[model samples]
Target: MDVDTDIDKHFQQLQDQKRMLLMAKSRKGEVPRDRKPPQVAYHQFMMSHMFRAGLAQSNENMIRSAFVPPAYQPCTTPIMKLQPIKINQLQLETHHRGRYIVLKVMTPPMRMTGILALGADANGDIVLLHMYNQEEENVREATDIVDVGMIVLVKEPYYKLTASKDYALRVDHLSDMVRLNEDDTMIPPQWMSRISEIHDSFEPHKAKADASMKKEKWWKAIRDYTAAIELGPPPDRLEIIKRNRALAYLKTKQYDAALADTGWPGFGPQPAEKALFRAAEALYHLRRFSESVAVLETLHATFPDNAQATFNLERAQKRHTEEETGCYDFKALQREAEHICPPHLDHATYIGPIKMKETAYKGRGLFVTKRVKAGDLLLCEKAFALAYVPERDEERSAGNGDITLLINIETEKGFMGGQADLIRIIAQKMYLNPSVAPAFTSLYHGDYGATPITFVDGNPVVDTFLIERTMALNVFGCPNSSLATHKRAMNNESMVDNVYHSCGIWPQASLINHSCTCSARRSFIGDMMVVRATRDLEPGDEVTFWYQIPHFKANMRDKLKGWGFVCDCALCQDAKQTKATVKKERTKLRAALTEKCNSPVPSHKAMERLIDKLEATYAVSPDLVPRLGHWDAQMQVARIYAAKGNMDQAFKSACKVLVFLGFSLDDSKKGFEIKKWGMVLDYLIDAFMFIGSALIELKALASAKKAYQYAKTVYRIVVGEDETFEKTYEDHVF
Candidate 1:
């Protein structure tokens, strides 16, 4: 007995240590990851240890003697047969049809994906139902995800083997599930609640609700309002009470609930101006700015001279413009980035002359509708949701700024978790403001096979698991608009390169496909992702950007392969045609030159020779295909030449750097014709700055001013905002 006790104690200590380690990880601005369980056959899951032995019997007994209400025949699925279900494949199998199933609660609800409970049909055949009220997840601290002991009429119940590896019916759409009340006449005598015991005077409850609202007790107000609503007030009084309850919901930030209340039956086809205004308020709070504008417009049509409605209409209009045009006070965004913990900006997203077009290479990609100059703003998008890990000092400075870390509940240890919290945030965003659902679900989701968002009762159902998979592909880690922060980030200062302090989804930017020779560039101003044209683009030109920079000379193809893409851009095409031995020789020379350049006493002649050899290895002309592998070496040599007081050679080398980036030179006149944009490289700014300085020394003022302006243009495009331009280059400003 002593030996057994000692062994158990040792195991317990190890488990405690593991828990501590997981807790430590969570402190680094992330929660422990949850591993999703693989799906299994319904029959197999029913026979598992979970549903076997005493558990199945215990669940069955819960509904054995208890009466259940006759469920509404809203919809029904094909009877899910008992265990040993098999698939008979056809050449073209029928899809899961829209259906519903009525079930009596047979077991206490458990939190699996959302909330799961065993439900039995009249025939005693059982299935698991998972329910979640998606929109209120972020608001109410004590919201019940799913209620137990209720007869639910589930429309279009999605039957699938869940992440828990069990076949279950998942209902997420508000319209999809009809929750039957215990007091309804349809319920059997034993199942129905006693009227006298449960009923409350409507007048008293409503009065209390109004009193609580005045005292600013939002939840108390909501509770009383709900109770009064349950008592079935007169139709005229009910409308006023519901609108009041909606105001309370808005105050508590339960936006979806507020929106639903505004849509209640009493608010019907031609609602009063007050009712319309209330609906507009809910949509505005929900971030459906465009929809809010539409509602306000309707309200204005009815009550044109109403002062309160007029002010709200203008406010909604301004927000709508911000959303459609992406115009914002960037200086404000900069200030917010400095102080805001997660840096979620309140700017509207702007999309320039770009449109999504079908492509041969990547299925679909962004393209220009009209000609755009280099540095012209293309798209500026606000993040739908951001998961940011602030520096510890920043965490404290932001005033106990607790960043919301999403922890997945299913996994035993969330060691490998990355996107769980973000996924949930995005899911909730879609659930509440489903007008943005089409935009979100249209992004690349690979072949994970999650169903499209289903609409029930005009409300969209949210599938968080689908959101998780989609977020994994589209979330971007980037720097803010501050040049100092961006420079420091590049040099491995406070935030590391591998895992940034922030990551988020910028919807419009996600449409861009990758190309080694990129035509556009993307940067961030707080949560706003700004994209600009790197080259002058004509109408119908495809816009492309690098998905990830290829810093390596070798394994570039392998890296592309890993991303499941094959680039046929000018540079990639040139690389494809080049001989392996010749490329190998160039790589060796580039490596040697890099080492020599980094040394204290370097042979300038040998460095020049290596650069000349590397540039020579490119089978295509620099004007045709920009070289990415060795631009740094050439730029470094240009700076060295200028430092050595060789202005002419430095200017030549700087011009060569331009060629390397596929920028066509127009020294024929003076400055530049803003060369054909090839690919975006890190050192282009340095190259232009050096060229401008060298031009000044060479007594070429016209060309020099042009270089300075070009440098400033690149600065705006790369750094994302212009407030820092003069500050960044104060001494060198023209």
Candidate 2:
């Protein structure tokens, strides 16, 4: 006995610990670290056990029962089946010191459970039931048990009922008692007084109320019913009386009262589905789309496949989108402008946050009422919104020929003419790569400028969406007419420019005015373009980034010229003289290198000499060689040589020009370099995999397995999951 006691105590301690662990996990705050691992394992083990036991299956009947009234149907599933028995009268008892209504009932042999329940037998003996604890092994043997023909008693308490589902029941404990033997001898003075007062009231008043209700004078009839309820017992017919009263209340537009009466104890306690729908409808009527969405979202979470909830949710979400883009309040704009723009145009000031105002037509790009900085991210649009046309088969077949390129150009111009200028704007700044060229190559004619168009009043309205890309230039003041343009312009300059551009950023460019000798410059980085103050200007001074620079490399100058505006900018004015002088110097360097290559020096000695001269010239003017054509051509040749293991030539070629091509070293070979590196990485990843597979094919299991592991590590890094290197360390090392 002592040993058994000790064992039971140990088991109880383990069980208590497990319960504590479960409680900790279910708590709102973080669990203690020492407890977490064990809890996780326990939870996973339990889940697996339950899954194997088929315990995870949905209890469809329980779910239905939650929404349905109990009296409306039998216990929904076999799990809740009640045993049937027969009885008659019930005795009710409670220790609570309050006035309560006793409902007499016969306790049947069936198992009845509920704190407050209305139970009925086939013989029409309706009982207000509660749990009765009889202290005997068998109910038949218990002296307190109510046998057949004995009435069970129950108490009804008064409380104001509300609309929510949770408050439907009136019970303090699950095990409150009821007995089938009616104790009429124990009727209290309050019960007798209630019965006496009810019986003493006017029957004519009730007849009059019933007549008014039949005539559809609902409000008055309800008033009469209230008086009658106090005068006598509630109409003996539960369903018919309740339904008639509910209809009368509804006819009087007393929805609250109708809902209340319907949700009373004897009636179905509110139609949950209809209540949810009504809530959604009310929220929509109030123009509270987010609230409507929230209600529908809650419904969907509880009932995911509910068609009405899904439909309402979609409607609300769509309304939200429309509201954001359909209407532009100019008053709101004026107020924001006053807040964001500086008081004086003379001083650099904070132009407030500018976002798109609603446009009248499709393809209307970003619009801002307040001033914006040069490098600010006006908006980051997904590609789908941008206007584009598919590349034609003929264009694709042109195999990089001029005619195919020309066809691409025509298609782009046609779309722009039809009011989609996104392609044209992009083409002005980006030199089309082979990958994107087919789609947008012909979009920009030599004369086309970078402007977004919106259709207003049946006419095309062009607006400047971003600051024009600018390179080397001195700043100057802008025309007053062009103030809006200058405020939102993005100066397109490479990283090497004193400006900074990050794709998703915009800074002081919002404040800067256009100038040939601007004190500030901006640069682009992916989606961010940043304008850093290169030179300070006095208050009210217009900030400007140079629209053009003369001494910039060949492709840079060409791109600016393509904007079709004359080079009245300072850079263009001086670049002609600068270019001639640079050309003469470059010619002299080339002659020296060629003569050295032809001379009878040892091959290694000659190569060393060439390296020194090239490095010096490249350091002095890296753009010299690549100025004659596209910079990418030179870089591509270098990459090809690198791939073939001609490391000397590849390194020399890349070093000669690619390094100094852009403002920041990071930006110099960005777009093209990403593509180039991607190719090389792909090859290396494949090679590792191939080597592993080859070993496996040859049945060299040990080597094959090791190679496979190494290959996986390489793949992981390529996919940007470098931490995986440590995960498979053993496989690679072995």
Candidate 3:
């Protein structure tokens, strides 16, 4: 008995020693990395066992259900099935012909101006149904609700002779079609059996296609859908498959393929109205504005009340007009830009005569093929990809619950994740349209090297790391125009609480070299970038735009950090040669001039001295200073002259500023207004207002009235006609 007790005590001592060792290791933070504690081990073991059992049971249930199909579940609402008529038995009789028939969709619904489908009855007799003049609400609701293998009850469907001279059914009203669920008892057993077989054959491919779509594997989705389509399901199912394939093609930027799938034969007129609309959309993207317009016009003639058709038709017409005329109304563009979420301008492309050429040091640079005068449109580019950065609070809710997932993208600004959001969107776009991957990858990735991953569906997937580097080097930050911001401010309730800083990629614009004294200026109208020559340039002159303001106080090294290059532009080179004494003198003069301009009532002598000093500095070292700074100095001098009631001097000084802005203001004219001012529209407005106010003080009422009128015209051009501007100075000229 004593020996038995001693053995038990020894076992207890061993157990205690094991526990103590474990506790010491844990306290020292040296717990065995691969081992779990007893509690955790037990919990994990139970979870694994339960998971296995549940999975087994699920598989068993699935197997059982596959063999013995569940009973048809009826819809909660009672539906009376009209007497079904066989497809082949239809006759062209006024009363007896137009009867209800139950049919299953064998093809996808093809949309043009209307939804078209070919459905089959239990007898395997097929008929085409053209649902035209569908209401917008009904079409939107039907997008997800209508699909292949759907059992629908058609009521009051009239027969029509197609171009092929075949009899078909026409369904016009939304009420005429009632789509029944898979388990609906309304489906005939004979039809159900056939549908079940078709479903079984197509299920695998369909599932794969759906999974690929969710993963944004557009090419895979297209391939799978095409395979399923070739299997020859019913007419409605075929249409559905074709539609899905078309969507995949569209996402991949294969506009031609998309159009073909929408029912446009290689050589023929437009297909059904439903498919025609899609063709028009594809044509629009391909920049075939005229073709798109023609199709839209035909669709509009058929369904004048279709809002979407009308809207697209008008847009096509506008794009066609712009392409032909090379003219754009800024007022209309501003209105579009003011939207919180603006529609993409995918139809816009590079419209100027510029080409990319390799440079000695710079990888590539844009060059002018023709002489460009000041204010000439150099390049108008649409963003390849873009995103609006929401406010801090709204960032959590901005995207479709994927915002947090996207925040993991690495960026230089580590904790500041706004750029990650933009790159995330670019990645999503690339995923949807893998064909654009080449163009996106062709962009300079700065210092970051590409880390290649395994190919997906035979195409290399874009790395987020490459995208982050490219975006950092090339993204343009566009602020909302003052006019847009002002309009938003006017309507408090309608205001978009977040001020979105738009980031966009202009692949072509990214080629323009950087210069402190740039010859071109860029502006944004929505996501579209419009670049105009700030100075005249001869043919073969490299087009350059300022990446950073020339007057910025930072040295070249500091300013060029983001650009990842030392600017060897003329201005920077000249700065290197300038004497320290001259630099100090210039800096002091600039400070004095700035102080004078900020004063409420600056002396005319002091302003004159400031302008003189600026002129001297420019004359001595033209390359060291920007002409824009000189223009600003002149503007201040003009304001000082105007304040001193020196109208003549003010007009002359203002004209100097106009010359720098690429405008020739002739004071000898009655109105003293040029036909066009090359200055930015916003600055032009201010210049005219200042000139008009000075004229009013000079008692030149007639001239002042003309100036005000010009201001009003410009105001109309900048802001849309929705709001009227109250005239500050009124005059009546008979």
Candidate 4:
């Protein structure tokens, strides 16, 4: 949770300037309530920290990362006494331990992003409490977050001095606070006031909601319906109103709210046909396809001729099977991504042969359950929550692509704009489906440690800041892929892309560790993360993917510092052992080779000599260590030789591309055979493609066909599935 002191100083200067402006306004007898400050894109990750002091001067920080406080932990003593803790009696710089204090909000939150409220305890003693690392409160979007008149419990409240040099009780963690229903027994007699007029207006509110529904104002109808329900209507009327609200919730795409009203287990069972149908629809949208199928089956059986049920049942069955197996329609996935704002899709998640287990100093990682070959499916997982911002040519410069921002008030760092939206969406999802919280919280959040979710008033308490930290570490930058755009989009990032149009949290895939010479390769089909093995592996072999493929000149450790781990992969180890003299020699040879290849009068002999010099810098043979930089040089020389119609040298240089990558080959009369598989990369497919072309030029059709077969195996592994391999890669001959 360390922050930049400079950012903190900048925040203080901004605060002083704000006070001066407010004072000048007061002098003019025109004071503004809730005055805001200007925020610029600086010191908010991209390097600088967000700092401890408030920089949230504008309304932009509002309405993000709002979440429910955790459930109250009851005292375990056999005889517990109820005593009111006086907030006024609390002293600054003191941690008041061993007391559960009840309090009621007395004012609207004065600050946002990180919220603060002036409240009175059960003893009627008023004090200020600031919720650190939180979002806006009392917003209509998520009313359960916090609002005036809401009762809460503060555990062992720390009465401390904040950065503002003001006294307030600081609630740093969600575990330290618990929201309670107004009817809780601990609520003081003075705080037990309810409006009789509002309570009796249920009928009128329901009528207004019906009118709104007719006008197609779904959100308005939802608000009216919520107001009506909270007013305490009779059971029969309440059920009718809830059902109406459930439809509105569905229209608004609030599946969790719809499910809650669809007679979920906690709510009394409705058992009616429409209720069952609505419940199934909610489950369907939530991607609990198996549950959806079960519900739809029951409805279809009783309502035999229901066409909607029949159609949905078929779809649910297909989706459920897709989740169970890794089969998916990749073409359809691309089609969906083409839309600017696509619907929440069930590309169907399938966890294949991999199992998550703890590793040595690596912490946790995914491992293969059985011996598997390259092209074998490891996992095909849909994102838990995906935020995709279509590239708008007018908004951001082209190639910078889209960005997602997530700000952590605790750590005081900002991630990106899209990330902020994603964090809010995830918080709301967890709020709706409590079961999902455990899976989300289980992901790595570096040294932030773990905090379990607790339910309050039947609603799961989700920590928003924990989500910020977890996502900052685990979120993957997903770039859209299309067969139309690039035949082998998997290989098109020069085997590594730093730019992405979207990002998402894929829970199962996040468990895999990083390696430069990783065991598996990942490709995106819309929001679906498809992983396949890069090389053959034994049972219990760890599956790893490149977080970012390191370049020869790049400082790998510095680049991946945010990820909080140094890669100890074979390639990284080899790079470390490589001497400075070798690197200098490789650089000099690469320049000469590039000059020879790109010259108006290109010299084939000079390029070949320089390529040989580059390849020789490697301490070990190509069979043991990867000559990564040499392969590109060899490919360049091979291309020139092929154009000159010198098939002999083209074939040799083409074959050397595979050799430099640690693969041994045999082209005896027995035909083209890969004697051993070493480090595998998508570029090897290109190498074989070059080899195939060279063979065809040499009139060895049989050998060319054999080379193509090798290319197809590499293609399957690179693409992550064989379903569309032949169609996508119709021609593999260079």
> Quick one: best lDDT, which candidate?
4
TM-score of candidate 1 to 2 decimals: 0.71
lDDT: worst 10-residue window of model 2:
63-72
Please, what are the lDDT tens digits per residue for candidate 2 over residues 624-659?
A: 221322223334444555556664455444433333
Evaluate model 1: give its lDDT: 0.63
Model with the higher TM-score, candidate 2 or 3: 3
Q: After superposing candidate 3, which stretches have Cα over 4 Å from the reference? A: 1-199, 203-240, 244-279, 282-314, 340-347, 390-418, 445-455, 458-460, 482-500, 596-601, 610-624, 627-634, 655-685, 688-734
Q: Which of the predicted structures, 2 or 4, would earn the higher lDDT when compared with the native?
A: 4
Candidate lDDT values, in order: 0.63, 0.33, 0.58, 0.66
lDDT of 3 at 14: 40
lDDT of 4 at 339: 55
Report the C-alpha displacement of residue 57, candidate 2, in angstroms. 59
Give each model a TM-score. Answer: 0.71, 0.24, 0.57, 0.73
Candidate closest to the true structure, highest TM-score: 4
- Residues 1-734 of candidate 1: C-alpha lDDT, one tens digit per residue: 00000123234434554454444334432211331232332334345426534543443322101001111122222223211111111011112345345666655554322455666554455666666434323354322334446676565455543333334565643445655544544344544543343445688889988998898878778877888898899988898888899888778656777878887324677786767887888888766788888888888998998888889888878778877776766677777877775677655677789999889868778999998988888988887776554533444344332222222232221211123335555766776566666677777558766554365444566665556556656767665444546566446576433344456777788888877677888877777788888888999888887666655364556655635678776666777788989878877987898898899977668788887888788777876776666677777777788789998888887787787777777753255546566555655666677788888888888888888878777877777766676776676644
Candidates ranked, most accurate by TM-score first:
4, 1, 3, 2
Q: How are the candidates ranked when ordered by lDDT, highest leading? A: 4, 1, 3, 2
Model 3: weakest 10-residue lDDT segment is 63-72
In the predicted model 1, the residue pairs found to clash are 32-414, 33-414, 75-100, 76-100, 99-156, 326-350
Candidate 3 residue-pair clash tally: 22
